[model samples]
Target chain A: MAVKAGGFKRRSGASSDIPSSSMADIAFLLLIFFMVTTVFRREKKREIDWVSAEATRKIDEKRKNILHLWIDNVGQVWINDQAIADEDIARVVRPIYAQNREIVIAVRGDRDVPYSKINTITKQLQAAGAVRVTFATRLEQRLQRPRR
Target chain B: MPILSRKQRVSDEIPTASMADIAFLLLVFFLTTTVFNEEKGLPIVLPEEKEEQEVSAKNILFLIVQPDGSVTVRRGESEQEQIVAYRQVEGILRQELAANENLIAAIKTDPSAAYRHMINVLDEVKKAGAERISLQMVGE
Candidate 1:
């Protein structure tokens, strides 16, 4: 007697045809996304020439409120174009500064101004109760250029 | 009467939702909308201290230093002039302290002025009973 034979076999699993290399592309995309989204803090600034020193240090940005004061090359002292006497500085500043709790006063002394003048002002500010005082300087400006 | 039997079959299917496109869109939106902060400066050399001290709110004062060796105090629209003298800064500072115990003073010195002028201002500020001092570098 001859037995009946099955003509075909049926497959029971799903096909795995998707490419694996696409994972790298997704990873790269995610990396680019994060890099684009990150935020950076801004640098605080003022325009002035400061005396240079060998050492430099970073100051905390949040703790201080800056006030700008200028001395021109021709020996003129100006607080925003208004000339003030050396003695009355405290009275002028007390009211405006009273609103802020912690303030940092920055001095931009002109190289041409007499050293004695700057010293006298610094002393006055200190006596008036300024907790922290800083002198502004430029590094490149401080470098002595040879006279031709 | 005859009853018929029903057979049930289960099928597996793949999902085709794309999240990468949405993520990319969001990233682009944030990149375009975000604002960057600008640098506000001239570099300043601050005085060093071993311990950090807190400045009282009521005691803070402002002093603007001009390119010339003059100091001024602001009192609203009007200004009081030339309060800083080499010898009398201490006395002036003491009087200010008498009015308010928590006196902190700020010095805004011009870039063109001499270093000695700043020192003098600092000396006067110290004499004036300012426990805390701050220096201003840029002019407004």
Candidate 2:
């Protein structure tokens, strides 16, 4: 916040009395700004147990550009938050890819899932022409500084 | 009259000294509760479904993920297709990838194998910088 120069200017060597009384107003303004801009998001029930990948890259694609495939611990497949039969992935993915060919397929599989389930999903994605596939993993982070 | 007016002005002023405190409280709350949904992943291309190409046996690296989270590795050129233990995958793939740039790491696993096994194999392949990966269902 820009303080009013004229109000805080020193007068007759009374520099010790420089005005800081408006700091409270500035703080309140910033508080109100954040309160107005805060977004409250809902929790998704389909959060999978993600494995950590050291080679993973942070995804920068927008929400609209992603098509998600979820594989649960039981190997059940879910698309767009709805559980889908294993064979139905190709059918469901066709129209979505037909609408936008630029969309990237994000495969989120549970840590305990089977390889076949993921293979089927990627196969369906290939059939749908969604060649860009990414597996979601939590990036391994180094929390502590290494002692040299 | 002056004293009464002074008392009235003092009472009229709003005490806003706690504004910074209140703002800090909110900032702390947000800092603690904010869930950063940033996720990361190892990316791969899903090639278009087409007729299987007859790749030379020398250019393939076969990997099998067992149901019990064990991996079996084999060189594509071997006639007998000997399966090695899962733990040695990284070293074998690393040496193979270094030797052949066009080597395809083909992963086939039983349906009963857990997903974790597949990811582990894929991770090692990625670390080895294998140029291509083929994922297919293994028939019983």
TM-scores of chain B, in order:
0.49, 0.80
Best by TM-score: 2
Quote model 2's TM-score: 0.76
Model 1, range B70-99, lDDT digits (tens) per residue?
Answer: 776542224445555434555666777788
lDDT values of the candidates?
A: 0.55, 0.76
True lDDT of residue B12, candidate 2: 65
At residue B75, candidate 1 shows an lDDT of 26
Candidate 2 whole-model C-alpha lDDT, 0 to 1? 0.76
Q: After superposing candidate 2 on the true structure, give the runs of residues whose Cα lies further than 4 Å from its correct spot.
A: A1-43, A98-101, A139-148, B1-10, B51-54
What are the per-residue Cα lDDT tens digits for candidate 2 across B12-112?
66666676677678776876776656647878887678956789988987797888867767677775555656546767898888888899999878787
Q: Across residues A1-148, which tens digit of lDDT does each residue of candidate 2 receive?
A: 7767867675666567656577667766766776676654432458689876655788788767777788877778888768899888888988998998888878888988766667777777777778888888876554583422
Looking at candidate 2 chain B, the ten consecutive residues that score lowest on lDDT are B1-10
Local error of candidate 2 at B118, Å? 0.9
